[model samples]
Target: METTPAPAAPARRRRSRAPFPVTVTQMPMATCQVCGRALAHRKGEVSAILTAHYERDHPELLGR
Candidate 1:
C-alpha cells in the first residue's frame, strides 16, 4: 500500500475599507447685545514652554 500527503491552502490577504467624507459646517458670527458692539470671544490658550520658563526663571515677578 502507498500513502500520499495533502497540499497546504493559500493564505488570505485583508483589504481596508475607504474612509468617509468629511464636511465642515460654517457657524455664524456672534454680536454683543449691549453697547451695540461687534463681539468676538476668544477661548483661552496656555503654553507649557512659556509657563515653565516664566515660573522657574522669574518667580519674583509672579508675586508683583
Candidate 2:
C-alpha cells in the first residue's frame, strides 16, 4: 500500500504599540510696574533694580 503526506503549520502574527504623551509649559517674564519696562535681572535682583530705577528716573516720587 502507499502512504500520504503530513499537513503544514500555521504562521504567527505580530503586535503593535502606541507612543507616550507629553506636556509643556512656560513662565512669565518680569516688568516694571511704573513704566511697564522690561527687566533683565535675576531672581532676587528685581527689588534693587526697581528701587534704583525709581530713584534715578523718578526722583520726584521719593518725597512721597
Candidate 3:
C-alpha cells in the first residue's frame, strides 16, 4: 500500500505590535530681538547673554 505524503505545515503568521505615539517639546534658540543676531546660552538660560548683546549692539534700547 502507498502512503500519502504528510500535508505541508501551515506558514507562520507573524504578529506585529502597533507603534507607540510620542510627544516632544522643543525650546527655541535665543536671538537678538533688535539685530536678529544668534545668541548663545548655557543650560537653557539666555537672559544674561541676550542682555549683554542688546546692551552692546543697541545701547539706546537699554533705557527703555
The estimated TM-scores of all candidates read: 0.26, 0.46, 0.48
Query: Model 3 over residues 1-64: C-alpha lDDT tens digits?
Result: 9999999999998779777998865655787867888865676578878877878888888884
User: Please, what are the lDDT tens digits per residue for candidate 2 over residues 7-41?
Assistant: 77687766565657777554345677778887666
Q: lDDT by residue for model 1 over 1-64, one digit each (tens)? A: 9978788888887768777899976433344333244333333322443444456666666673
Clashes of each: 0, 0, 0
Model 3 residue pairs with clashes: none
Q: Rank the candidates by lDDT, best first.
A: 3, 2, 1
Ranking by TM-score: 3, 2, 1
Error of 3 at 21 (Å): 38
Show where candidate 1 strays beyond 4 Å. 1-46
Q: Which stretch of 10 consecutive residues in model 1 shows the poorest summed lDDT?
A: 37-46
What does the lDDT read for residue 5 in candidate 3? Answer: 100
lDDT of 1 at 31: 43
